[model samples]
Target: MTIKSGIICYIIGIASAIAQPNPDRPDLCQGAYFTEEEGAKALQTFASTYHDKASWEARASLIRKGIREGMQLPARPQFAPLKPIRHSLRTMDGYTVENVAFESLPGLFVTGNLYRPINATGKAAGILCPHGHAPNQDARFLEQAQQRCATLARMGAVVFVYDMLGYGDSKQCDHKISKALTLQALNGIRSLDFLTSLPEVDTTRIGVSGESGGGTQTFLLTALDSRVKVSVPVVMVSSYFFGGCVCESGMPIHKRPTHQASNVELAALAAPRPMLLISDGKDWTRHTPEVEFPYVQNIYGYYGAKDRVKNVHLPNEGHDYGPSKRAAAYRFLAEYLKLDLNRVLKDGKIDETPNKILTPTDLQVFTSEHPRPADAVVGDEAVLALLN
Candidate 1:
């Protein structure tokens, strides 16, 4: 049988044994679905089927539709007025941090920190920093997350580091709710809108980067939004590993009766645009240099823009967005987004010493003194009701 047919049978066998879909186990397929050699062969088969730009674009269009339908996202509502609240503007050595929050929908709030270069000129490049699934789903307060955003700000970019759904101060719904993917995607899109809306941001020089589950968000947003000129999805793109979180694979985006695709394909949809795939040896992306990277590079080749895509494989590292992974992403963003690299570079290494990492409470958008808005949706059922 063909690879797709065989995989379908495997999935069917698993589903039949369960009798009902497990809400806790949303991923129909994980990284172990194929061995290394099998994944390579599967990618080759998919790539060989698309011979021209038209064919690839046709496939991309279908994948995009599937993603929307699977997520149960309706026609996007009119742009909600971004009622932004900014506080605690602290100026550091080369950059400044401000706690900010804005509404993505009527009552759904997105919260996090915004970092900007102290000496930015006319229109600075904009970068969106989405954090992965940490222990508490904390957004920007993690040292690594703060370090990356602060370093980027020091390098002369306007970076907005926002919370994922039910993370940090966005506690309107549970993090693992069925619609997590839909809400997070919507929040990312709105974050882009909020970023570009800034008078200091250059709309054409926008980029998005995130690691792990956030990496899933990075590519998904880039696939749906053309405004993101560059993408760096770190440690989460795989041919067989359709993400493990409800926020990643909770929906049926990767499979349908007649159509099948993978995160490798979703990521490649950002082709012709600059992209950097950061993979590590211990994660699902360990095979990226062999399987995923080449598959995407092949798509970039179709547009005669092969050089725009790159992969930096850390064969010694694990899944987290550690220091070395951040360095690779830093160089790519500096090169593609036209940010000054020297500010964060010391002896050819990233120097995050200039960043002043704050405690989580410092970045909190709502506290006892500043209460969550009276209109904020509170329970899982209430939040899900908004989508319906």
Candidate 2:
């Protein structure tokens, strides 16, 4: 094609990005929407649009507005009572785990295990552990989830390891429902609410960390809500790709006729606040060390807080929240959240073997004896009605 035609095509692409997205065909930007060179060029273009702190804030505000509007997010609802239920406290090594359930919406329940340090004296830092897409109903029940939460708890953090919608015991709605992105985001906000409400938690030290789809949640929640003071999104931030799941990319947050932003920009919204980006060589985040991290670091530089943002790249690792990833996160959280890492530290290395993994049945919230509340909404349509 001629240079003139190339320019025309570029203009058309820009126009398409800003055009109103169709509801049915929701302007989805999923995995690897751009190649490495293309992603770098996109960041350069975004940089040109914002030179100084004020300009960057203006651009950031547009991105925030775009996310709120494009996601069709409702105004913050006055939270009805979360009506939290807790049972079966099991104390181990240096931490204790309990089954927990709370309502995010009036009838939409969020389920998980709450991990707290054993014999704590003062208010502890609160950490929200949102799980990624695991097979079957094993979202937060995965051993990695158990280990991290338990280990963090042992290190003196009040950790809440919760399920994603339709995962584990959060069965009120299907995970693939329309506006799932919106619901999960809301659930996350409410999870923060629940965490802060605990008398034992220190509200000022709130932090969040997750992998894959959960990593998507980590940044989204941190970006939209300033309540999250520290963020560690493992193996997910990427300029070349938006998230792949409906719960991650089903909404049109990345593209609107008036604005366009990438996941890297969304993650950068955590600027000035401490954040750790954990990336591996096997996924979309493979370019994070060279591409995504520097862009975000530049954004942090705008606030003169470049030291607060960090990137840990593992070229030999794949896309799961395995041991090495967890170790990196633990160190980051300990340093920033002021947790007693020495509790779980053994011979100069993080020791996770003390965490006892429970079976799915043991961690389940609603059993035959304690059934789902009769007032609970049953389907996606019912939950969406409440949100709308």
lDDT of 1: 0.83
Global lDDT of model 2: 0.85
The alpha-carbon deviation from the true structure for residue 30 of candidate 1, after best TM-score superposition, in angstroms, is 5.0
Give one digit per residue, the lDDT tens place, for model 1 in 138-220: 64577778889999999999999998887888888898887898888889989998999999999999999998778999999
Q: In lDDT terms, which candidate is top?
A: 2
Task: Give the poorly placed runs of model 1, Cα more than 4 Å off.
Answer: 1-37
Q: Which pairs of residues have clashing backbones in candidate 2?
A: 18-257
**In candidate 1, where is summed lDDT lowest over 10 consecutive residues?**
1-10
Per-model TM-score, in order, reads 0.91, 0.92
Q: Model 2, 247-284: lDDT tens per residue?
A: 88887898888777888999999888999999988667
